[model samples]
Target: MTPPPGWYPDPHAPHLQRWWDGAAWTEHRRTPEAPTVPVPTPPGGGTGRARTVALVAAGAVLVAAIVTGAAVLGSGDDGGAETRTAPTATASIAPESPGPTPEESASEPSADDPSVVEDQLNGVTFPLVDGWVRPQYVAQDDVVMTTDGTYDCPGDGTVCRHGLVVSRTVTANDETSPEALAKADISDAAEDAYDRDAIGQKPYGGMESHELVKQGPVAVAGRAGYYVRWRVHTAKGPGGYVQSLVFPSSVGTESPVLVRFVFDAGADGPPLADMDRITKGIRPVGDAGTGGGVGSSIGPTG
Candidate 1:
């Protein structure tokens, strides 16, 4: 029988942690902070379980639909402020984007393209900088890209990379305010990437602490959106930065899309400028340019 959805430490390897399904280990994992409630299993019943697994296997090829392929809001604090009035600025220039077609739900962009992560399911693409790569790593279904290689984590059980970027649609909730969603998701992003390693260790010693660094409205892929960034201090190594950026889809239903980032702070980490470059370079897929498509960059100011 499947046990439940929760994280347990590995006894033989105290530095490692793993996610146990009732009968075995599944891919996604997390760390506990304070005493916490167990993450409920994604709702699936007797009949649905088999079909859900089968469908996921197929979605693996195309990246699935926005509603099915992205994140459901997780339990995080209201870390961002209420929406603020946008500061006046010149809008970026770009060709208008056409809505994505239903057929795109099955299209897979080349991860090694070195220029863009054409997220057909989410109806947007992220630009890749010099040191990043699209990776298929541990618990990587939602991971769109990461820095070139791994480093020794401060804790045990798993390796660490200097940077990572993940994209997910906020499919579970009805909220559409980008500020509210970005604010609510940052804590979860920090915890997921740093605070705990589902497989066994606290990568940066489990986000020792954090402070909001920036928050405000911005334009992503020509859509109005909001972002929240934080400077996180971990229990070990040089800590890093994490951001949650939320924008609406350009295609059907205009669902909210969530893009999360993680970057280590020291010299070995990816330069922070890449974050801004990536944000500015986001474009709707099937656009005219490849290396540096014209996209919007009006985002939160420091």
Candidate 2:
């Protein structure tokens, strides 16, 4: 008679049970319990304790085979020995949980936050005020530094404009001072605008011509520098200002770096004093304790 569809003592290993599907044995196996009573040995054969040990060893081998997902066949010990075959069943192991995302794993401070950002270039560092955004390409290019600001214009709902640009170049002329450079730069810009007919253009509504209102020697990071201020002539409404700070090369032979601050006065934009505040805040990128300004030793030039 065939066995029922249930667990029965393994025909090949007496210490373990194998699942039978009413026919052949399956790959599933489990140890119910260690035999409490000694397993009997064949007549005139080994002792009962020895038989028990052999049964325990067989149970261990069966466990290993199951863990490795291998099929084990057993032979029945009836009048005729019969072979049992089982289909292979693989062991299931759960997958590991995923790791943290890029945003979650990042520990560096956010660049978007309204805080000072350090710009490292030309062996100098400057503090960029809150709400200013730097472009990725600026990191690779040291000669040019640029930042932008956004605000709601009087007629226009919202607008973004260039807030600051610091352009550096190596000049061989050691005789040139910051004051001279500032004058030349402002003069050149005014001349260029006039030649291009950009002046009196309504790109900025009512912005007609540019006039140099101030030119003076200023020190930045305790170094000699000069600043030139320009007033925007507007046909109507409050006008804007353009200011440039030129710092001569710390070393006599190298060229000076010019930082320009352009503020287009919107109905809601910052004042000229606020623009000056930004200019005075310029310091070597890493210098925290020192203030940036013009040296008293330098005098203002018309």
Candidate 3:
């Protein structure tokens, strides 16, 4: 007998989140699953009360996956405890050994592979899946980061993909301090991103949903930071789940941060586990305690 047409468990594949397409498990269950249907516009533009809740629930799942992944990845050296070392301090303490020469890295598969790689930016280290590139825009409130690219859609050719991870900042004067604002912005963006034109009638089926969940109180250097998750049902054309993480400026030491991941949606494994592994290893540049300035930090806008 065949399994149903939704998510199912696969004894043959451990750590894999399998989806039934009314057929056998496709050989490609290594990535997140995009909705195999299209998003339904609420009839008569009815207040998408359920839709909004679903989107929020989805976000919570995504955030949990990321933070969990980070914790697992960072556990290789320490017994699963996050080290209190700042990326800046670590870099200054020991000059990084030069990585593969451009010629060498080029010879190897591109860093933009489904496998997320740890990247260092401005003394910070974060995970970015291979292939997708950051959106080109000014760093301001609302326009946090954008990434557009293509990825394999299992059982189909590659599909066009674009994701925008936006955010809003809270200055010292704001009622919410950097600490509170960080969580609020992330939680709010997760909510707003799913609201009016949030998904822009993207082709995902109505099965998509969002949930708010705790990610972490992981240490960013000496300061503490939290993580939130967002998961949205997306079009299955490209065959992979696409989601973004928006952290308040305080999370990345007062600079808003957005990270996106897109891979074969039909991938057989649980996406959260894979995403968790990829993101947990990331180490941002500075300490959130710094309370960075707007002129230098990136915010939500474009």
Q: What's the distance in Å from true for residue 35, model 1?
A: 53
In what order do the candidates fall by lDDT, top score first? 1, 2, 3
Pairs in clash, predicted candidate 1: 2-22, 3-22, 16-200, 17-199, 17-200, 70-169
Question: Order of candidates by TM-score, top first?
Answer: 1, 2, 3
Give the alpha-carbon lDDT of every model: 0.64, 0.49, 0.35
List, residue by residue over 193-296, the lDDT tens digit for candidate 1. Answer: 88886665666667778998878788777778888898888878888889999988775457888999998888898887787889878877666353332234
lDDT of 2 at 94: 16
- Where in model 3 is the C-alpha error above 4 Å? 1-123, 128-179, 186-201, 205-208, 233-270, 284-302
Model 3, 103-152: lDDT tens per residue?
A: 22212333444222222211233334433334343222233223444434
Error of 3 at 241 (Å): 7.8
Answer with 1 or 2, whichever has the higher TM-score.
1
RMSD of 3: 25.1
Which is the leading candidate under lDDT?
A: 1
Model 3 weakest lDDT span, ten residues long: 293-302
**Which stretches of candidate 1 lie above 4 Å from their native place?**
1-114, 289-302
